[model samples]
Target: MTRVAVIARILPVLAILVWSLQGVSRAENALTLDLSDYELTFEEDFDRLDVSAWGPGTRWIAHTPWNGDFGDAAFADPRPGFPFTVKDGVLAIEARKDEGGKWASGLLASVDGAGRGFSQRYGYFEMRAKFPKGEGTWPAFWLIGLDRLTHTSEVDVVEHYGHFPGRYTASVHVWDRKTASKSSSVHHRVLVAPGSLYDDYNTFGAKIDADWIIFYFNRQEVWRQSTPEHHKQPMYLLVDLGVGAGWPTENTPDPSVMLVDYVKVWARED
Candidate 1:
């Protein structure tokens, strides 16, 4: 074969190879984080509300199993019917009033009232949820120490107050032995658009490591900070729709619902 003939034959093959490489590069760049860096540890789609590998009965307890309630609203027992339901592959936590006009909402904790369930030291946690929109309603996907909040090491991945619409709060707090009744915290009030959280589902994520805690919204990092030394223990998850953190729920509407699509956690593949 002539030299020119050989060159022409090889050139098209080289071009095709180059085009294929470029396509792969674009796909990697579009991903928020290389998921290959971690191993799946926990996940919940709420499709059946209880039928996942890291779930069903292995991960979440489905109920808070506690006594009293906190915040501006009353927390109802995380039971089968009233405030909690699984329908159309989604978990709905509804906030409503009873016949006497008293407020009630749902709260689910990974651990039971006796403080026993799944807990992780450090990992990446994420959730897809649609917030309930109405005055005085507060919906959140958060985590606390497996030992409970008395120690005060709580990581608020996404907390949406209905009064504010599209704004969500992400915060990390440590209140251990050294706190002396005080606390150290890093918090951010993230704003998107007015009532945006109600319009569609959004993914909220947090990567917790030894030195840092990074927060993400819609798979994009939004805020981060150095990890506090006091947060050195394992933590469990919580999802709830409350009437207020400390404010009154008198203005809250009777029928408010927060829809959850899935929750996932991954441990770094170190």
Candidate 2:
């Protein structure tokens, strides 16, 4: 064979090899939730409605005038099952409009409502959840002051506004002199290309400490920033399914559910 023929054949094979390697590199970069080196403090798998764990009883309290704020939906107690349910090994929060044309949803807090649950100072917190597919459906996994922040310190693990498909945000807010303003606030929207987060369960996490706060999606580090000063105290966890947080709700579906596979908290033993 002439040198030109040999070169052409080899070039095509080399190009194919390069493309395959690039694809592999991209896959390797995606981090799946891997538990390692942290001592678990709490976990809820939703195998059943463990009322002793966190439904309408001692483990967690349903929303009341105290712990319910944000978005256009009102959080209702899960007694009549308007917004929350544990079925088929998953905890689901449904967002819908009532007969009065008002929106109602679910919001669960660890240390508020009628009964106080648990709180931790600094640790690793995570939730494995699948978002609902509907415009204006807002879901959040977050932490706030246990009793009161004194100032206001909030850690937003994952806030997904369903209208912005394939993206979710994380943020930290340290209050200024008042709750309306912030001393230091950091936020970012993690963009996942070619896939929808609502299509499957993905883990969102936050590792909190005295110095810095790290946010993760699917167990991969996505964003980080300096820790807030007033956040030195403990915080309680919360999850909510909200609607129309200033997002367009004209076309929002009548019913949508955010499925939570599990939620966990971990700490360092030492």
Question: Which residue pairs in candidate 1 have backbone atoms (N, alpha carbon, C) closer than 3 angstroms, thus clashing?
Answer: 50-56
What's the TM-score of every candidate structure?
0.79, 0.81
Tell me the tens digit of each residue's lDDT in model 2 across 1-270.
001122234333211111111121121255454457679998888885433223444666656315434677777767656677888889988988899988888877776543367788888999999988878888899888654525556788988777778677777765432322224556676777534677788888998889978778778877766776777778788888888777788788888888999989998777
The C-alpha stretches of model 2 lying farther than 4 A from their native spots are 1-35, 50-57, 113-115, 147-149, 177-179
lDDT of 1 by residue, 1-270 (tens): 001122234333211111111111111122365567899998788877541212335445544544445554566645567577888878998988888887787777776666666678888888899988788887888877655345557788887767777577787765443333354445577767787799999888888889988778787777776776656678788887877665467777788899999888898888
For candidate 1, give the lDDT. 0.68
In terms of TM-score, the best-performing candidate is 2
- In model 1, what lDDT does residue 189 have? 74
